[model samples]
Target: MLQSDRAEAAEAAAVIETQCPFCSVQCKMTVTEGGKGIPGQRRAEYKVEGVPNAASEGRVCVKGMHAHQHAVHSQRLTHPFIRSNGELVPCSWDEAFAVARQHLQGISEQHGPDANAVYGGGSLTNETAYLLGKFARVALGTRYIDYNGRFCMSAAASAGSKTFGIDRGLTFRLADIPLARCIVLAGTNIAECQPTLLPYFNQAKENGAKIIVIDPRKTATAAMADMHLPIRPGTDTILADAMLKIIMDEGFIDETFIQARTNGYDELSVYLNSLDLSQAADICGLELEQIREAALAYGEADTGMVLTARGVEQQTDGHLAVRHFLNLVLATGKIGREGCGYGAITGQGNGQGGREHGQKADQLPGYRSIESEKDRAYVASVWGVEAATLPGKGVSAYEMMELIHQGVIKSLFVMGSNPIVSNPNAGLVEEGLNKLDFLMVADMFMSETARMADLVLPVTSYMENEGTLTNLEGRVLLREAGRQAPGEARHDWMILCSMADMLGKGHYFRFHEPEEIFNELRLASKGGIADYYGISYDRLRREKGVYWPCPSPEEAGVGLLFQQSFAHPDGKALFSIMEGDPWKGVSEEYPLILTNGRVLSHYLTGVQTRRSPSLLARELENFVEIHPITAQRYRIRDGEWVEAQSEHGCFTVRARIKDQIREDTLFVPMHWGGVQNVNHATRPDLDPFCKMPGFKTSAVRIRPLHQKVYRENDSYTER
Candidate 1:
């Protein structure tokens, strides 16, 4: 039985403990049921309380405190909907499934199985993600299966895999944060984005740890740092190279550790010799002394760590930029030890587990490549299918959308993600969606993307589901279903099962519970990098969480990876060679550099958070931040309406004048959609290695809006 089912079967406990479904921190929370007669019925009213766990210690964010509000909101989708004559009307489950199956089969018969694709979300539990990938490949017989996580941390994953031969979010635990003598936070405003993690940094600060924040603006996180390197947009690679050059100049290289722990030092040293600190400083628009001081502080520390976020990972050179940061850690030999390692802060709830368990287009479960014949044979055996029946690798998420725009992918199945608001080039994505022959979305609410679908399937929220999620620290925690799904809404796993049955693949997808699927996952990942063979739901209950690579039942999971040697075949970490050329520069027509980020009150795309009254009250609309000098140059005042135009598109938002950002840069939140969508102005240029979009930096021009367009109370008329 599932852990949630087991928990519900217990009659004594009124409050059930589960992990929060927002962000990668996975903060533990207890749901107190009120006036409960039966476990799943009796008009379940709920409240959230913080529970101590490996990721968070009894601390919940404002969003977590109110996450339950949207689950039972009046506007939540309770039944399936089918579009007829340009209007969405409630329909029966059988009719909706029939329509979906008909279109899926028709599309495949007409244009082959390659014409159909599946796009999923990072918020899905490991079991659902694994089954979704299986459904797409086996039931639909389609090769195109990818998730929204490609945009979140793929660059870091690609870099980490190439450098260390394995890609887990963090090599060490969160408890090690306070033990590090120095930490460099690159492109992450953890104070607002992941507030539950702020206490760790606070503890680190209390212990005299030096915090160096690298960002383009003086965010809430940067304000608390010992030193903030306000870098120019898209110059992360240049800044990283300059820091390495400075470290070498100060003779801070650990020769003994280098000889004992890593490889490729000679090649990296030759490349570092070609880089000039002054040139990099000029390119990054930062002072040489600032770079030197930051490098000295990090290099001089006995044990230090580097953490990258969406800022560095959303660039055209994202993979290379991440590799540059890894090079710094390798040079200082501060890895594979307590309080020292390189990590990428995963943004979504199950971004880590979702990617590890076969959601990506190019990977199988256990972080194995789909292209490997051995991996295919092993996974095929586990699924009771012939190895040759598996389809070939498909494109990334953005590439899949492009194919849809070109009429290659005739049908699409979207689950848990609202790509119309979240994907890069939002206007183009919507246009592509309109061109699809058939589009279906499964979500808890009628999201912006769901409104565009031909058929919309109502699915239960995280509170009404049971599964496991891997946090940013690689710890796997259980998420229990606290209440019954309202109305006709079903769990995503059940929905997938029903769809598989309708497609005549019920024999392969015959699991009746989530635990059944999870057991299969354990077998599939027995000998892989993200091995979860030893972890069972019962074990997870006894221990709050367990890290991966627990190969045997008697062996406890390892909190710190690569303690003795790196995962590479040679047992040595590799350093990346830095690139000298700067990223694409700004053109005269679009002189200012425009960047985007998230807000504390609003999660990605604002599909769920915006529906909550509390979160909406905190941040109702989007605004762009411009330096005082830039605002003055554009003849725009604070709260004045302005149009930011890039080569891709233009968006209008209120201007907030501040000197925190660079004079030539502007900042906008990535939450609002439609006319307020910042992604409309973002370029779709992707990293060559990981296919991550360059959402962090785009060249644009700012012009004050017409007087009539500006409204009172610091708001602008929506276009």
Candidate 2:
């Protein structure tokens, strides 16, 4: 049980009570109370601990363990702040809201409604995201808003939409992974990103599943795989296409399922006629033998699933790549079956929930399209807003930033995103932020992007708020308020309501509690394709978190979807033809390719985990991971201070040599910021389909720094 009062704790104890809401593993904890454990208080468990719940399983990583400390860190914004003389100063909420109204209204008054852009993060609660979407379309009178999910799961969702006529993934649950006999993973790093699911992978291994890993990096998960294919970056679609060709040529496809359930087979067949195994193998940097081996292994397995992550979906050709991957699953009749399907592992904890609840610019709740008349009318009827007034689609995250830099977007209201630290092409986002006539940011901490804001509003941490969060597997769980909010910090939803009220659009946000907002979203979802018509707050609370498609009282909602028929108009899964392409940044001048990712110790941007004493004490500072050969070539020593510079920008940090990385590429964790922000030197190029910047690849040079290395004395060399 948590203490009733936070006031009695020491300064250090109060700092670690916040929750880390970034990834699918929502870690719950209590901060250490008061002073760094005095002699009398040494026995107290001041460190944040994981809640013993079904969702968390009484386990947590470094990021989740120290999440609470971030809320009270030095960078936390305690009050409403307004920019004065190019400096941010603490101000009253009234003053902040006044500035907001003035700037936003002025932008609309002068340049028209289209000039304002609203950007939300996937990290936001379902309630906050839902209201933000409403505000963008109704109050702001603009359709230009998209969350970071655009960069994370758009391609996968779009691929599912094309195949199923609906944009959801598994009808199956995360628990089903352990039951699989074959798990075909393409371009995803699930083992590192979603550590909680690792045991399931091991379970599959124990069940005699042949795990096939296709990726550029030989990750820990890949190393554990029965087979790992080190394909060239950006060439995933090619491999997928080759597998389809083999499946069709060998007659492994379910002809009955194809004829009875799908559309567009002739077009796909004609498209695949041109590519050969040798061509695909050559382009993808894999041998034909390896491809054939992987294909046969996957096809022969009793049960299988093709799981992907940001790696396959973060490239310019991401959509096409996913489409091809889905093609293989459809051709083999692997989908809609137990322990076999096409699934994308979401990075953020609530990304699935946020998107389902209508955080996207082009979508309404229940995965309904905003552009469709029926959907718009049905949702409008439920939301009690005029269907005609609800605007159409808007630009995505990368596009918005481009528009901002191009001067098409003059003002931006950012919620729960640290684009300055998280987005690729950090320089471009910085330029865009500096150019904004008015920038409003709502967050608990004054993050890198928030620092550039014209107005910053202090918001409550997850532990201080009440709402529901849906995990990657579509399990919606309640978030109970366990601690008191600091200073004037308030819930993010409340702040939006106050802003809406000031703007004379209070009706758009009539709810007083997040639960009320969720009820309205559910109402808006009625009669839609991704319908949760039978779902209510009551059902959710009663069952932990129910999966979507919960439209019947008897339906527990299948975890592995598409077991009977696909959501396609023809009720069948369709295949797409794809070809391989090399990484866009491959060049002679910048010989080595660089990639970015996260470690078990940190989450995105390091804004939260870095602030926690428990987690930070584990890692002193930011460092780059590189292959020993590459490091030696640059005259770099292990644990040596160095500067990594790219064409876009540069940063200095210590380098750690590890053989896990490929000699031709370098790996950097995405969690670092301040003096060692990785995005500073990252390029702005985005995947053509999803518009997600190529965070995995960059061209960079490394040189040893004469300065002292931070971890020179640490004994990381031994276990």
Candidate 3:
């Protein structure tokens, strides 16, 4: 029996402690199964309340309170389905498996293994994410496997690896934020997405810490800052380099830390000598004095903190943006001590762990490059396969859609992602899906992407499964299964294992439970950067949670990293020279910059949150947030329909004019999908190094449509 089932059978406790299934905060909460009709059968009576755990500290957001709807939503997939004559109909599991295997094998034999691929979600647990990679490489023999996290955390991961030899999001704990003398929040909206973490920043402010926020708009988080640097979109690197120059000119450079712990300072200094703040001020749309004051406050602080998110990491030079920000943290010696660190605010629940364990296209079991022969051999030995047989590195997430459009990839298996709504350039994704010879999806609901799949397999949710997840702080957490999967829904392990058996790869996938898969994963990840051999379900429960790089069971998880030496063999961090690049996304026809982000009431793609009446009542549709001056230029009015047109495509949404944003910029929520999708107006251009799409930067022009176009019973995802 499952652990939760065993506990309930014994009546040990009425409420079970579990982690929230939404954002990376992973707030710990208690769930009780009571006042239900056969608890977990037809309906689940889950009462969720926050606990005083490490991440949230007894604070629950609206999403966590309503997360109980995932199991009992009206449109949840209750059985396996297959496309019959252009219509999806209910089918038996055996028929679904037979169809999936026949198409996958036929596609491989006809075109090659590269023609088949796997696209996964960052919300999956570490165990499920690991097995998804293995299933692609071993069962299907495909090299093109990547997850949706490429759109969120790839740039930050690349920058962290290049600078410090490892990427673990936060090097320290969230609890340490209160001790910092200064904190810089760049391109992250903490007040809306991670409301639970605001307490830490609030405590830092209460302790007399100065907070500086950088973004194009004066967001709610920015409104409370000591200084707000309202910058132009795609100018993150420009501002960071300017700050480094100011810190050096003001005599705040830590020469001792530079000489002892890092390299490449002289080259950076030489590059800084050529900086022009006057021109930078014009490009960044900020007053020169605001920039200087913000830099001085942080440089003069005894200790500093820097936290970056999607705003800076979604541009064409995203990797360089993150690297430039790291320059400030390293040059000021603001790391490896109390109240001093750098981290990326991961957006998804398992975004950190998902990228660490083989979900990335070019990564192995433990964040090791697939092109490295040593890494290949070590991982092959763990999987009981020959190193020569393993596939090499593949393309990234957005490039997979390009491959499908180019006819190089014909079949795809997506697990728990709604790319039709989530991926940028919606037209390109829709076209690629139309060209696919076979497409299968595993999800609990018919998401926008699942609606186009050739086969849809019913899968379980976090409330119905038990596995471990790593949060943004590198802490590995255990999430307990609080209820059973209703109807014919099954765990991802069971579905994958049965499919492997049908494909004649049963020997490699003989796992009966999630723990068995995690055990094997622990062995595979023994020597890699994210070394998780020390993490186990038992240890997780005992310690509450533990950070990664725990190489042995006798050793505790290392929450504090880089005390003396960096992860490199030479015991020194590498400082990348900041590059000055130009962003010419705006043209005469499209005179304004466009940015899309999440709203306070809804989650990604609105696949799960849209199902809840409470969340929908709070936010029924995405709106176009524009500056009043920008709105007046186009003669647009607030609460009216407006068409935002770009070179890619266009969409009409309600216009909401406000003075909180730049006059030359526009903002839109990225939750709604289908015809109301905002991603249709964004470019699919990728950062050359990290392969991250420019989801936050686009060029567009807005015009009021002068009418509201809607039907009484309009549908989007189900359509």
Candidate 4:
């Protein structure tokens, strides 16, 4: 309001361009680095505004605008900590590194190299993920390396690889949303989980695109759809199969595309002909007419798209569900055309790129399978190591926890992940962590998992560090930082390099910056499926972002995949037949289906999001969402405490009785921790194909708080 105030504000302002760290949309924005805090908000600093980007066209959500507050929170870890007699205390970095080296080497020497393990997270940068995988293989000489992405994206990744021979989150760009004539969403709450993406869907609807939604809960996304099929949990494949059969019976099949561009259709057609629409409808708790309408709408469209998320992927038969959906797109000639394709919306900000570089137990950089001798040799050459020295595939994420409980894995090095709140059946994960001979965690704050660690290393958050992230569209963008990390907090790669030096592998891990590590990544990824040999930091800055498979400088990047042919050697996509009973396995003793998901207020595990004062004020804690009929059956009142018990564990929380969810199902948010953490009651039954845990369809029973059993039995099965 005054001239002096305007002069002082202009004197201290410096702008920087960056992106959000919450989800896969990766909305870009500009921040005033030295600006004052919001006019009315406390502890929230820096002024933010959305900038135009391909993924998010000049729009930012509440999480993106205030994401920087957590980076400057007072509770951040400023110094490395080493556990004393019974508690963790601040210590010097050298002392902490020395203790870590001593214990890691001792464990490896006594029980062999397989005893040492490394666990990473999906939000880690490409360079950090690549180096972490190398540290596990060369520095610790261990094979136990995996990440949290296995819990979030592995099911869709497996199915995409099996069908299309490549696994990118989206085959095309986000700008093509308005060009589609029909769209189908299965088991995903896009409105709450990815609010910034709602604009594109809104534009599509305005442009005359028919939308179909399949979910047990009448989510906000479902409310906006033209048709909502209130299907039962764990029965997605049955509904998908029924649609496939309807498309065929109604003569919507593209004969030319089936003959020229696909395989195994004869077998798929045989099964589709045998599928009964009425029987499938009864099994899935849906009317036959809803299924027929959705199928015919998609079949008659000139250009169509199908997208899915954890609702279909966090099941025991998750891979089968993705396969069936991809089959629907391919059989009707919906793919490889402008505005027609299939994509799985990635939950984490870097889930797409994290899996491409490494950090998975069975994969190498560039999406190469570590099991292949040639692939191993090529990557080994890039690392200046012999192929024979590399370790083979170890195990999946949840299985690694099982090994920890079995005592096969004596020590673990965790980075950027909090399995205590993110993993399924987290009670068992906590018990296994307690059994570790030595446990180390690197995080920006004292996460739930960090509280149980023998050593805790301070690391920088994305808002305080510079790196690269591949968003859901497979666009590799150079992310910038607006402020320096507080205290002695350092980058994860820097901490890892120090550890590698202490382990006597300094030559291979000699890198002072992210670009040096990224250069090495380019060489290792040269000929692999996710080739990035030609992409450089300078190129990223000039072009904004480049898609993967940019094998040469002149080629730039390829956003549209398979315009001519599929990535398979034969240049054709493949379809597989699925046969089995589609059931959530609910019994009379545990007759209700429990589903886990995210809310609009918080993110996965709530490590950083909860620290933000404004984000926490909206949803202070988690609650059990129950239908009116189910609440009446259990004699539970609104706002009354209720206990939900499963074979895995039990959690008691306040009940919010509503009619939005199905009568046979219960919905719980996945952002909280402690006694009310929903993961405590989620099943860990993994899919046979991708090993993704069944977080969607757990058999559970509920009762009023006072009427609960006095003695709760604990059944910890290593599933």
Candidate 5:
């Protein structure tokens, strides 16, 4: 039998504590339990106690305080369930395993393996991610497997690897930000998203450092900045070219460093000289004076750093924007330093781990390209498979959705992702999922997408499982199970392994323990950017969290990467010749430009956060923020309902008057589902290079709802 509720009280009263596993700050937290519940009931409630930590300083946000609520919510699925007569019903573990295996095998035999795809999320642990990747590549023989990281960090990773030969996984140490004289926060709302990093920004401010913000809207972070340039969307590359032109004309570049550490600078200089500030100002929709101030401020700072996030990376020009940012840093001699560098703030907690474990279509463990014979042979030998039989790169998320709708792909296994609510052109994505011959969804909750699944396998939540998470800071921390599974639900790793064994791939999935899987992953990661062969659970416990590249047993973990030299072949970061066109979708018929992002009260798609009363109380419906002038032009009043229509679909929401927004633009948080799904209106046109859709901007129209003298269908009586 499981331990009694008294155990929670005793454990909380103990001296030891753990950290919140959500974000990178890794705030230390002490656990406590509420007094006994109704006398006859055996349930106990857990509470969070503060611990002295760098980020929280013995404090936590509302999300951290209510994390336990997420674990034990009534909506949680506590039993193995299978679809029967178009409705999911609880079933035995053996029955669930048999149904999943039989369907997957039947689909693979009838249609090629390429007809099926798997999607993973960054929330899974390294051990779980390792097993998932192996199951897709080694067992199913399908290359059509990708993770949610492709939508978040792949562009940044691609640019970094192309320039530095290694990706920077939150390697910028907190101890160094205070030394920098200037900090450029571009396209990131760090103040609200990662509250833990605010201290470093505050420390930099105290040290007399200049702060510059580049974004389309004047966000909270921008409001406090010394200078904020509201550059037009999709025009970052043009601005980069203008900056390079000014740098070359004013002789501000580090010639010695360029000559000694870089290549292609001369060619880039010529390409940039072809473009000037006047033309760039027109293309970027920024005044000449504002552009000059931002460029000169950055060029003149004693030490400079550039920090970016999803706002910059989720667009169609994401890769070019990243490469351009690298160019600016390298030209200014900021690549290798204490407080000055280029960093991409990751979104998901384990985004770094997800990409590292071979969940990407074209990559293997250690980030070796699957198309390269040498890399393939190395990984094949490690996994005990023949290199020749390994499939090549596969379709991305957008492509997969389109193919599924076109009847080219017949089956899919979705793990921990809700693309129906999160993907662009979500209406089409939903249609594609509905049309699939077979659909399997494995998650803790019956999410919007899971409700349409042909099979739903109940999986354990974070609190009920023991695993590891790699945060935005590149620190890897261990997770201890805080609660037992409520019913028959199992960990995702165990479920995947069980299915693999039932499908006759038992040898490759023979691990009885998660640590054994981790050991194999460490072996596969040898001699790569992240070396973990010498790392063990005991060693991780000895330290708070270990950064990668601790390849040797005697070596301590790395805090700052590329301190002396870059990983690039030339020992310097490479810069792309940035060039781009202007925003092309807006028109007289569709005068307003629509932008999408997060609100502090809610998370992505609100699949879990919305269910919490505390979070839901803050916001239960969607609202669009429009400039006061624009709202007046549309004759819309605050708290009044409005129709927001795009080319693909339309959603109705309340209109809010805010002077912070640009006059000709609209700001809508993309967390709502059912009646107010924002992704329904987002276009699917992708960045040519990275394949990321242009979700940031689109043509939109807003109009006030027609008022009626009397309500048509009144459910409430007037008092």
Candidate 6:
């Protein structure tokens, strides 16, 4: 078993408080030790209770309540595995490490460092992410490094940095939600994706705040909104442009604030003037009055906020879409004040902090650009390495996979991600994995991606590991270890450190504890945008949580950013000029638009959540949500099996005929992989600026299945 401070016999049964490891909400919870347990043999059973926190306020989602179950689940990986004769078999840790080192070194020596790459996950702690990036650049000497955050919130980060010079996922705290006069939540279903946040919206509603939801379907969150503008899929930019045009036409533009705190207003005005609301309305399939009403409600409010999610940030023009959405906030002067600002709703645990560290392909610690010589020099000094030794910026998540398929990236190291099920095109990703000369994966479970690795290492889950996670509001909370890890399972950081030692880079990675790495991270991030120089593990435990930009101990963490000035050189935000058709037209063969999203019961890829019997009972299988008109045209009945096909691939799922969606669009949940994987049909078209795959929109056709069938290769359920 993994080592930990043994609890006293009397204290072993006491309750321990920790943060949920699921979504970015990071709700606090108290886990009570229940069943009888051995001293160092096995972990005790846990009963979870919601604990009060700044974000959740004593509320927890179903997923969070049952999170402890997965830590000691029967399916948890407890030992290392090495491929032998086309099958993975149990192996000693030393043998596994030796094999991995041999293959990695051979590949690097033959093909150079560029041929090896590392793909990380957004769920990792700030310290793990920092070290992983350092390991990839300094130890591996490879420039190819990126994380799953590329698919989560890279668009928002790119747009926020370009506009305001910094990105923190949110500008204010979650407690401020109820104080706004109006909130425009575009393309996000917070009610389901983040159930604990619904109470904040409810409080806002009780305070007479008008809520406007912009989405193609009437989601659970939309049902509670004052108005739901069910625009056509991928028309977010057009609708946003129309709203801006109306706001300008009605003289709602805050000229004084614009002149004082922003630049490029003339460029924005010219673009707004060129947009025709009537034409945009036609293109978006919404009445012109609906657009005007949304614009009026948002602009007329004394204090309003705007938020976007994967629905808008996963498109080809995701960055442009975010920039145009911010125009509404800038025009109305609704930012940098109490309960007023624009931000992206981060989806993954530590999504905000993960990107701030050096995990992205083009970023260093503290959100510094890797291409900047000054930034590189600063980071190099912290690592005690020559600045010129660090490799430059590399390709993104999808691009790295493509390189693997082409034999350009000969070896890959994956941590905390299941790309086979989570990536845009599963077939393509699997082919790339098969083409790799060496593949190493470290995860708590034997995930689909892990199954393909030449060597798989077992790692501890959140409940059994101690680290820190940054919530969506940019609040960093300590995730205390409440239980012991199962046999032979180590923390991801410990495993990385051991691997670094085996690879002849032991001098650089001398971390014996998470806090040691965290201290180094604080120093590396001292002067950058996400400065955490003064933050410490002791401080986090004492304060429960602290926001970023905490430069000193005397000053309280910054809960609200840009109260007086922006992060730009001139202390002003920029208005980006947007130009493009937001919509990708439907073809004659594929006559409908396919939109995919997450469900309440399951998290991304359903790797851990699906293991919980409670969650699995709620959402047992995947299904396509089709409008009544589309179902009638295809002769598909409610709960009938149907095959959805796109130009890339096809998958079969049951159709749930409902009127909540638009007639021309079909909705599918993206949590399922294996035979029911919707990503099989998802196109690999990526946003040029951010490299985010277009998982939201695809052109596809559906037909009723004549016979009851299940794909023979469906392996997700077997676990």
Every candidate's lDDT? 0.89, 0.76, 0.89, 0.90, 0.77, 0.89
Give the higher-lDDT candidate: 3 or 4: 4
Candidate 2 vs candidate 6, lDDT winner? 6
TM-score of 6: 0.96
Candidate 2, which segments miss by more than 4 Å at Cα?
Answer: 1-20, 27-44, 47-58, 72-75, 248-251, 552-555, 578-580, 643-646, 701-719
- Ranking by TM-score, best first? 4, 6, 3, 1, 5, 2
lDDT, candidate 5, at 343: 81
Query: Can you give the lDDT of residue 391 in candidate 5?
Result: 84
For residue 249, model 6's alpha carbon misses the true position, in angstroms, by 0.8
The digit string of per-residue lDDT tens for model 1 on 1-719 reads 56666555455346766777789999999877653444455565567899877778899999898787787688889999999999999999999999988999899999999999999999999999999999998899899999999999999999999999999899889999999999999999999989999989889989889999999999999999999999987889889888988898889989888899888888888988888778889889999999999999999999999999999999989999999999899999888899899889999999999999887999888887899999999999998999899998999998888898899999999999988888887778889999999999999888889999999999988788999999998998888887788999989989899999999888899988889999999998888889999999999888978999888778899889888988898998888874734576598899989999989998888888988888899988999999988888878999878889898898889888999999989999998887888988888888889999999889999888764355578777643
Give residue 169's lDDT in candidate 1 (0 to 100).
93
216-318 per-residue lDDT for model 6 (tens digits): 9999999999999998888888888899889889998899999999998998898778787789999989999998999999988999899999999998888
lDDT by residue for model 5 (21-79), tens: 45556666766645453245476556677676544567666666666666668888887
- After aligning candidate 6 to the native by TM-score, how far in Å is the CA of 280 from where it should be? 0.2
Kindly report the root-mean-square deviation of model 2 from the true structure over all alpha carbons. 5.4
Task: Give me the displacement of residue 356 in model 4, in angstroms.
Answer: 0.6
Candidate 3 lDDT score relative to the true structure: 0.89
Query: Per-residue CA lDDT of candidate 4, range 1-719, in tens?
Result: 46776576567676778898889998899877653522333432478899998888888899888887787788999999999998999999999999999999999999999999999998899999999999999888899999999988998999999999999998877888888899999988899888999988889999999989888988999999999988898999988899988898889989899999999999999888877789999999998998999999999999889999999999999999999999899989998888799989999989999999879999999999899999999999999999999999989988999999889999989999998888888899999999999999999999999999999999998777788899998999889766777899989999999999999999999998899999999999998999988899999989889999899778878887888899999999999797745865799999999999999878889999999988999888789999999999989999988889999999888899989999999999988888989999998888999999999999999988766344446533221
Q: Can you write out model 3's per-residue Cα lDDT over 1-719, one digit (the tens) per residue?
A: 57766556446335667778889989998877554333454544567789888889899999988877765787888899999999999999989999998999999999988899999999999999999998888888899999999989999999999999999889888999999999999999999989999989999999999999998889989988998998999998989999889999999989999999999999999998899998887888888889999999999999889999999998889999999999999999999998998989999999999998897899998888799999989888888888888888889988998898888999999998988777888899889988999999999899888889999999887788899999999999999887678899999878888888899989999998889999999988998899999989899989889899999899988887798888988989888896848577898999889998887778888888888777888998779999988888888998988889899999878999999999988999889886678889889899999999998789998887753344667622211
lDDT at position 460, candidate 6: 92
Candidate 5, position 411, lDDT:
82
Local error of candidate 2 at 75, Å? 4.6
Model 5's number of clashes is: 0
> Can you list the residue pairs that collide in candidate 1?
none
Query: In model 3, where do residues sit more than 4 Å from their true spots?
Result: 1-16, 37-46, 707-719
Which segments of candidate 4 are over 4 A away from where they belong? 1-6, 35-44, 708-719
